[model samples]
Target: MSLLAQLKILVVDDTTTSRLLLRDALETIGFRNISVAANGEEAMKMMTTSPCHFIISDMNMPKMDGLQLLKAVRTHKVFARTPFMILTGNADRNVLEEGRKLGLNNYLNKPFTPEDLKKALEAVVGRLQ
Candidate 1:
């Protein structure tokens, strides 16, 4: 199999629509090993049980937000080096700042097209071919 097909990816978002959109976009870009979580708390659980190479999460969610999840991931030695990108509609600088402090790899605002998603992913983890 191609490397992209085995590159495990996690998509965390509160809204089902956003999660589906991201999953679809990732699939369109040739990623097959993708998983989804509704909130950061759930995402964390998924992360520990089934580790991912890349994480694409939203900034805001119930129980735990993206930054919290990022903090958790970064603080933990196992997932500390994993590539993390926040795909959020939130424009709050404070939130983004927190994410940066927590070692966010990259971020992309919502309402994004598949091309935009590809570029964002490329920016985070190099070209995905």
Candidate 2:
């Protein structure tokens, strides 16, 4: 099977284009189960209903931010171990460090290429199987 087969990924971004681009990249990489959320609140709601194995989220968003969502996920017993990655434009070291403390699996800067996404997924999921 392809590396991405049957892997459910949740992509959270306030920008429609970002979500579309990420989704397309995942599809190109052979990921079949993919979902998108416009903001953290939506992502949280989705998480409660339909759990995903992986999450790629933006740090800055409306309603709720990536950190808040991450904390929420960590607090939830069902999602405590879920792999979460951050895709953001923030370059502040403090912010990155904070995210790291929150247990983010990987952090990718903005304008990331498809290869970057693939690499991050490989890093997070490759170890499992």
Candidate 3:
């Protein structure tokens, strides 16, 4: 099987609809193993037990937010180099800059298409078939 098909990804979003949308987008991109967390705090807990290969998180979630999650992930020895991406509606450069400082691999603006998602993933982890 292709690596993309087996890549384990965690989708962290506060809203149920957003989580479902992101998960479906990942499935459409040929990723089979996906998990969802309602907030960054929950995502952190899940990461400890499940150990995903990647994390795609929303920036505005409560209970730890995306940047907090990114910092936490980067500080962890196990997930320090794991691919991390943020999904944000805000176009503020400060947010992206902050993510960069925190070792973010890539990020995508909200309401993106599957093609955009593929490109973002490729930018982070290389070309996806």
Which numbered prediction scores highest in TM-score against the true structure? Answer: 3
lDDT of model 1 at residue 61?
87
RMSD of 3: 0.8
Query: How many clashes in candidate 2?
Result: 0
Q: Kindly report which residue stretches of model 3 are placed more than 4 angstroms away from their true locations once superposed.
A: none
Instruction: By lDDT, rank the candidates, best first.
Output: 3, 1, 2
TM-score of each: 0.94, 0.93, 0.96
Candidate 1's residue-wise lDDT over 14-109, tens digit each? 999898999999889999999999999898889889899999999878898888899999988888989999977766898878888888889999
Clashes of each: 0, 0, 0
As a whole number from 0 to 100, the lDDT of residue 42 in candidate 2 is 92
Q: Which ten residues in a row have the lowest lDDT in candidate 2?
A: 120-129
Q: What is candidate 2's lDDT per residue for 14-90, written digit by digit as tens?
A: 99999999999888777889999999889988999999999999989988888888888888998889999988886
> What are the lDDT scores of the predictions, listed in order?
0.89, 0.86, 0.91
Whole-model lDDT, candidate 2?
0.86
